[model samples]
Target: VWSREEEVRHGTYRPQSSAQLKATLGKDGKISAWRTDYVQSGDAEGETSFIYAIPATSRRHFSYQSNQRDGPWRSVNSTQIGFYNESFIDELAQAAGEDPYQFRRKHLAADSRHLKVLDTVAKRAGWGTPLPEGVGRGIAIVESFGTIVAEVIEATVREDGSPQVLKAWAVVDCGTTVNPLNAEAQIAGGMVMGLSSAIGEAITIDKGAVVQSNFNDYNILKLAGAPAVIDVHFIESGAKMGGIGEPGVPPASPALANALFAATGKRIRTLPLMTQAKA
Candidate 1:
């Protein structure tokens, strides 16, 4: 005998744009030009306008399974996310009269997931606490692999634009943790992987051949670049372990990005921060 089951949940929220500037208001008290269409107007005069539009939409799906007739079940999941195009960001920037990063930060602050991660990191890293001048700190987190993980990284940068990984702390809640040691290792390994990506490592192609062939050119984390401290804490629950394989990968990238921003006053958007370290 064989049996199978599947369940899925999805949702989307569209935020409406605010009204245009009062100075640019039409006779009917409504902004006629869509925020996305304002650039063509070339209203470079003293007039400024505001309009709201959707940038990008996201969809998520989750799944679980039970194969045995009387044993425990397991879960397998994935997510597909799409970011807004440059035009969407430009329109949003024009409407808010602020840079895209600032606007996105404001919008992300209102998201429940982002807020949860931010709050957790703030508490974990002692957000308002004092620190030395050369020591820089950053925090970020994400939801994936059926769990939520938050990470905070501390580092220092030299005049030549190289970043040193000093320490990292992570918190995860994926229901009940099946193995404490494994969980700790996963988080620690994740931090090192994140560190390597931030400081060194890249893939290149030349003459239709992969330029970087071995670990000599494509470097992983070395002992010197590894974090001296990695802490992982889990919230206990009677439920089963929701995820154990890849949940640890997402938080470190963003945390490293935030750290780079603090250390160098440079906001990096591309992958492998080392590639743009000089930029």
Candidate 2:
């Protein structure tokens, strides 16, 4: 399961009247710049977590969305911002003796929303097409925050013994998309962010403090290690407004892990696949 708090800012600009503008301008006929800063801050505080049963047959995805101030926010937003707990993937895969990607796809296919995302990503990623000798592809999807997200990752091992994320194809359905450009950016950004976690990032705890204090230890994927391409597609069902905040996280880790399994015979059970690949 996952939990988060988000604060968003919106600003509006209004031009002052001619008299006010003239009063502010200097006698030299050049207007001096006067600036006033205003802040409108809103806080969204809530907890969302999920649990899955063994055999991976039973899955529960739930979340709650409430503002610091009083008033009902739409259920659509609430559903889109809930928790996604993936702890059951490993246990279920073990129980079925099946690949995690296959298991997840099988389960997700039962839901219409998830199925649409899977279909779109598969088509975009060329799921069944052949690849070079060392290349492999893996795919996974999750339903969170009223959105269904699916991702396909291609990975390979380089000569220096490092795993590389070559490309990522992502599909998301957040009901009716408000802005296509922003939506595309959101998905692409999420994939890159997830790539960081998959390849070379971690936060460790020791004794009672965070042991990895700086970027030296808390690494992120750089331009050299970043995926060459991330393709994002959105499904417009004309249903309702869904989520855009965090639906991008769940798919990348597992997809990258599966891709690593293809590049190497090893199945990655933990995150930061680069660490294990190097070892």
Candidate 3:
């Protein structure tokens, strides 16, 4: 679904990606192995970010795009890779005809920190609980900068097919939480940024120069479009401290995408969903 022409790109420093992922499942419908090939280029090189597995058997290969104009880079390039792979995991679950949340539980190790955090978000969000018609819930987990974070996003599609997020539940296990309040803020801010990037932000070029000079075209998330509630929880797993700031951003996009898919039968394989999702 992600072709080069469909790749999001423009005059901004933001990167672009082309990804192809394939997996094999056992007779039990559990993912047995996978091979992921993705190419991404930004102002700097971005390798594959992260993947989740129990008995790991997967390979990911990264390549640089020769055409990008180099500038600066982001510390959380993992967000892009995490978004790609995590969404594919949900796709795998759907192919197996299993519930996405429970499917993740089956594939993730039972006693590991990843599962613990995943379970926490599901429980906190009341996974499998009834929702008002037209509302759908999506769950995603990602580990970036060593921190494991899971998120559940509840949203519904507008008449125009744009997703309107209603609520968010996030759980993180990054070892020690020296300051609970600040850590919570970090996660919340990152999640908001991630959602903004996914749902509304886009860049275009005209005559070798960037277009969309004002908010009219270059839109960002507004308060009305934000989730009504964001609940953040922390888990100290007594392991080496990972990171709090960047980990929160990785899982937000995938969770929202999955939520929108649940709300509408259409899957999101494109960004700036405000424009692309109408189809």
Question: Which candidate's TM-score is highest?
Answer: 3
The sequence of per-residue lDDT tens digits that candidate 1 reaches over residues 68-186 is 12221111111101011222332334455654334334444363444455456566776656666766666655555556666778877766767776778887767788788988887
lDDT (Cα, 0-100) at 78 in candidate 2: 20
Predictions in order: lDDT: 0.50, 0.58, 0.79
- Looking at candidate 3, the ten consecutive residues that score lowest on lDDT are 42-51
What digit string (tens of lDDT, one per residue) describes model 2 on residues 39-87?
1122222322221212322222222332223232232212112211232
TM-score (C-alpha, index-matched) for candidate 3: 0.89
Number of the candidate with higher TM-score, 1 or 3: 3
lDDT of 3 at 242: 84
lDDT of 1 at 118: 46
TM-score winner between 1 and 2, please give it: 2
Tens-digit lDDT track for model 3 on 1-279? 653333334333567766788888889888888777767654222333344563545545565764546443233467777777778988999999999989988877669898899999999999999999888899999877778989999988888867888999999998999999999999998898889989988777677766656566667889999999999999988999988877888788889989888877678877767744444
What is candidate 3's CA lDDT for residue 6?
31
User: Quick one: best lDDT, which candidate?
Assistant: 3
The parts of candidate 3 lying over 4 Å away from their true place are 1-12, 42-51, 54-56, 65-75, 275-279
For each candidate, what TM-score against the reference?
0.60, 0.64, 0.89
